[model samples]
Target: MNQPASLPLAESLLAAPLPAGGPAWLDAARREHRAAFAAGGLPDTRIEAWKYTALRGLAQRRFADGDAAAAARGVDVAAFALPGVEGPRLVFVNGVFRADLSALEALPAGVSLQPLSQALRGDAEPLRFALSRPALVGHGREAGDAFAQINAARAADGVVLRVAAHAKSIAPVRLVFVGAAADAELAWHARNVIELGEGAELDLVEQHVSLGEQAQLATLVSDIELGDHARLRHVVVQDAAAGANLIRRSGLRLHARAQATLHVLELGGALVRHDLRAELVGDGAQFHTRGVFMPHGRQHIDTQLAIRHQALDTTSSSHWRGVAGDRARGVFRGAIVVAPGADGSDANLSNKNLLLSPAAEIDTKPELEIYADEVKAAHGATVGQLDERSLFYLRSRGIPLGEARALLTAAFCRAMLDDLPNAVLREHLSGLLIAQLPA
Candidate 1:
């Protein structure tokens, strides 16, 4: 039983591990990422990217893996069962994608689904290419982030989705991160890569829910690449319980004239962090991201969004809203950067938070860095309690106090979810909002 005296747990988690067999260069990269994942941020203070997270003393609770199959009972997946949700849905229990338990009936043409492990060995060229590309570069590197590195090193499992060019599927593809387990209750790591071909269109709903009672440590990383003129509508749902360690990071790249709009909703988890990024790498493209997080109890939720405008005539917008209740802690950081020569670029980033309890904590940051003077960019942050006038109006209308509060809170998040291209997903997510949020 030895502690690193003054060293921070966050830093320790970044250090390197043993190397893997890959191309020499790739192996070197993996080794480097491994070490980085094992290293630390000395003292694990508020100075790093994890400042607003539950980083202190994390070393004392190193994230571990849980029972592979025993966690199905504890998670709240039963709450989301409803009619009209279509297509093949793959459920991953504790980071292991379960194809046998998935439903892929009536899937559309050109739609191929493979587990990450299966894809890596069979027709995995595209996925391998995408995985090899580092989302973090130069000063843009959260590249040094251990969580990302750890995800990279241990990313042998998870989900892989491939859509062909000019194909369209009405069925919503679901990648459910099921967190139910029994003994050996610990952590799970998931690596997912989704590829959309030129002129392809798809709607995807990603559900993250814990299934069992043991403290679940889950880390998920996704890389999405959009081909020319492609369209994708994505909804990310995070609704863990009061005692789960969740870390998720997604990196997206957009090509010419391609458009992708994403809606993110988070309601639970003891400790949660999301590192989401959208890169506009092509001309005449647009990336829109919207998110709402409502955490109750003593939960901690942190969302960091960075959108890079890498080409000309590209537009990006991000709006994040959160309602913190009980003794919850909420953190939001939204950043937009217009790279040099990315002229005619337009970007807007905003974060708004509502604190419902005296003990609730909220931290919000909106950052805009523009290397191009011609780009139109703006950033704003706001934090406050519910509007008293609105509360009074609800009460005057004979609404119960709790009902009115919940209604108002739900309304604040609707703008972020209602715009989802998939009507079914939008409604399902809306229902999940009230279902997951605490009264």
Candidate 2:
């Protein structure tokens, strides 16, 4: 197959100068992954993973490499900031870190937060060790998809968080990636690495948003490692302009007695896809995930999740909800895998979606692969519209027909929105959904 013109930009950008000098091993890894991405090109509908969401729009857009030194005047910092959560905050504009727009709180004794580019230049061994881990059983590659590899090969800037053993953080860390309006289409790639030491705990939030109507493409990759008895609560919110294309991939590994909880809110974008994978490699490891994707108008959103139990007595649970209105489309797939000898493992997965318009569409698939006899695993999916009885009940209470429908729709999504650990964010998302609900 002939490569798209926009695809060539990835190779060109990979050959560009590195943001900072890294170890020899890290440099070699980047070159190899870049080559692999060049060979694979862009994924199309033929690929099982991308069967529903096509990449034609991404291929047709002419995206230039994001300029790291772009002025910060294009973004409004105050308007986008979270309401109540106060702590250290990092801001990135078009994938480049902006110290001028960031604020740092007094760090706890054992936590270190720095930019990935800066950490690489400082010759951090933890980063090298984390990236050196295997993507699959024998592959030591740091990425699972072509877009993830492109991010690793041409990343401009991102966050690197490290917590010392037994350290606990009371304040949450926030990372904001803002897309700037530009005359020419632009592509921005960033990779974030987070490591939590044994017995440590941290709360992290990531948000992606756009400032104007500029056509932009954003690719992000996050790699996380949790040590024994560690806990991490993560939340992701993506709200991009209608002319933007967004792709995000997250890979996580948990150790014995470690726990990871994730909540995602997908509310805005012209086209968006988020892939999340968690591997429990230690006995008693736990993973919990929940997300909500509400797409309206002609927008499209896809959410994919895979949880693997590789150790005895591990546990995994995942649930997601989606709402599609107008001519929009929503897709969800949840897969749970229990490896051989993973005895006593328990896993559950479910996906639910609602369609408010006849023209709107939704596709959902839940899968389970159990290789261990002693393990327990189940998966299911549901797609339907609002219950007529519930709508009628609301109307009988003196609410107008449109208002009744809106209230029921909002209530349906509010169930998942309430899972957010951050109270301020939950309130904000509730208001956003209420304002966007169709009458």
Return the top candidate by TM-score.
2
**Stretches of candidate 2 exceeding 4 Å from the true structure:** 1-20, 68-71, 131-144, 419-421
lDDT of 1 at 76: 44
Residues 288-308 of candidate 1 have per-residue lDDT tens digits of 988998888888888988899
lDDT of 1: 0.74
Q: Supply every candidate's count of residue pairs whose N, Cα or C atoms clash at under 3 angstroms.
A: 27, 0
How would you encode candidate 2's per-residue C-alpha lDDT over 112-221 as one tens digit per residue?
A: 88877677777668687655432221233222377776777677578898889999878888888888887677888888888899999998888887888867878898
Stretches off by above 4 angstroms in model 1 are: 1-32, 40-43, 46-48, 66-83, 133-144, 436-438
Clashes of 2: 0
In order, candidate lDDTs are 0.74, 0.80
